[model samples]
Target: MIDRSDGQDEVAGIAVRIIKEGDRIADIVKNLLAFARDWKEEQGPALIQDILADSLGLVEKQILKDGIRFKTYISPDLPEIKARSQHIQQVFLNILSNARHALNQRFPGFHENKVLEIRSEVVEIEGRRYIRTTFYDRGVGIPGNIRDRICDPFFSSKPRGEGTGLGLSISHGITKDHSGRLWFDSVEGEYTKVMVDLPTVE
Candidate 1:
């Protein structure tokens, strides 16, 4: 009960909220429960165009601001995929930000120019087409031990308390819900590449 001295009774007004909340203390759940509920009910995957068109178009400014050179190799005629649009967007953004932060901003940097690449391809497996998308960064790579649990909740390389540590786990779940896969390969002093593959809509 935070004190409110302005003659306004917030506690009295919240009586209805408490009564409606029943046995659950919704106030205690800090994370984005609303978003999580929305995700849980997404059921099926999002349409490919809905996820890609807007996301790719929107990241240009952020990339330039971070001095990251972006390159794309998407097939012009690549087919659609199924996914949760917002979650998928989150996955991409998370990876992009991680790559940006990996850059040696103040120390001796990689002699090579900083670069990021995204490529999309459609390939057939068992007579069905699957869309394979990959994101690669020419920045510092992740260590193997941490990579093993990259999708584990509450596991993050970022400084303590700076990250919720749920982004990768959420992204992994979204990939699974779409009947797809997400993986990455990295070398500590080399580069990192993240791949996402989904069955193309038939």
Candidate 2:
């Protein structure tokens, strides 16, 4: 009877896991649909943390599958910003995608330092408050020669047919449209950090 009870408990654990996975997949589908729909030119107050959560939901599984450690440090009490949520989400998706690519290129296999870290905080720039979201990756950093052209249209270091070269360009434009700033800092063969600063709703 004891052995049978243990087997039943094991089955229950598996069932629970399956149910959780189903829920996650359903959430992913919902987020994807929201992401793919057309925007209606409506901008409103949005929580940056919520936008980041939705963006991560779209790519977190794949990043983990690639054996890169993902970490986040989001502060509580972050203020809302005036934004088109979908567009801001796109910018985050681009940054996360790039970070994943860079980590894969550098590691190609699991390593202790293969990591992606995202953090957020309220920052004051020019006496104005803004929420600064930063993505840092220990990956194949940007080369000096192409750093200046990284945001130029049709400029991609990726192999042929792999990239359209407009990800960063479009992200930059979107940030500007929202009165935000996007910039990058990197050291070749070491790491890359991308920061986006958007003003808080005053």
Report the lDDT of model 1 for residue 101.
Answer: 65
Q: Could you tell me how far off, in angstroms, the CA of residue 48 lies in candidate 1 after the best superposition?
A: 3.8
lDDT digits (tens) for residues 58-148 of candidate 1:
7768766666777778787666676567777777767666666665432234434677788878877678788877888867788877889
lDDT (10s digit) by residue, model 2, range 97-155: 99999999999999998899999999999999999999999899999999999999768
Query: CA shift at 4, candidate 2, in angstroms?
Result: 70
lDDT of 2 at 74: 99
Model 1 earns a TM-score of 0.74
Count: clashes, candidate 2: 0
Candidate achieving the largest TM-score:
2
Give each model's whole-structure lDDT.
Answer: 0.71, 0.91
TM-score of each: 0.74, 0.81
Deviation from native of the Cα of residue 5 in model 1, angstroms: 30
Q: Clashing residue pairs in candidate 1, if any?
A: 45-83, 46-83
Q: Candidate 2, which ten residues in sequence have the lowest lDDT sum?
A: 31-40
Would you list the clashing residue pairs of candidate 2?
A: none
Cα distance off (Å), candidate 2, residue 160: 1.2
